[model samples]
Target: MTDLASLLPGRFGHLVRQLGAFGGVGVIGLLVDMAVVWLCLRGAGLNPYAARAVSFLVAATTTWVLNRAFTFRGARPEAAHRQWAKFLAANAVGGAVNYGVYAALVSGVGFFAAVPEAAVAVGSLAGLGFNFTASRTLVFRGA
Candidate 1:
């Protein structure tokens, strides 16, 4: 843990540590996702969108492993494969929320449409809270 992570408040310290660790895993997952997508697109010559799907699935699995080992260490003991499935199921809602928010923002707001990347960022942020909640409370309960 960094100095910043070490400074987490006493009462809600677990939440802070989990969030920080989750963020780190997310960064790593992003890299893995990008690499997979690149490989699918450039090496396999697959459709760009399909490549994204492949990458997304890979990254989801990677993040589940990382989160289980780090962010939610000592969570309810269960089969590793089962835990990955649970993570995916819980994240489905978060993914929908993110896509819905992105679509709504880009279509409903002229400013957001003009800067689609910003709309995506907003959508991502909107889903973060729900994802964290679901991951901590449902997917990795008893941590």
Candidate 2:
């Protein structure tokens, strides 16, 4: 019998490495989202919630491109656009969950005054697993 690892293509290892790299990309996107949300609310006069929604869109889009290029490099070409749309839809759910969690952590616990970044981090981390799983299964289903 063949080894399970050998059953997969050579790029399987590369895909795993790319997952780590895409995670770094996600981190950058998160920073951009946070900065934009903060600036829009605190500096630009937009409503706080509005700023967060807008920033989330921008960040999710950025992550999608990086993920397509890196994490799922072996994804099928014919379904690429459809996969991206599904990915974005899944991310919308994740983004909403993240925003809700952050809002609760900030308002319910009043952590914003002391550590606003902590709230964002906690929220985003909570949503990360769900997002990844859904994106892999529903969006970029390689099988």
Whole-model lDDT values for every prediction: 0.87, 0.76
lDDT of 2 by residue, 1-143 (tens): 85454556776855556556667877988898998898889898899889988897788778878777777666666465676678779988887788888888888786574797999988888677668767666775672
Candidate 1 local lDDT, 1-143, one digit each (tens):
36664677774877787887887887898899999999999999999999988998999899998998889997889888888888888777888988899999999999999999998998888777778888999889888
* TM-scores for the candidates: 0.89, 0.63
Q: What RMSD value applies to candidate 1?
A: 1.9
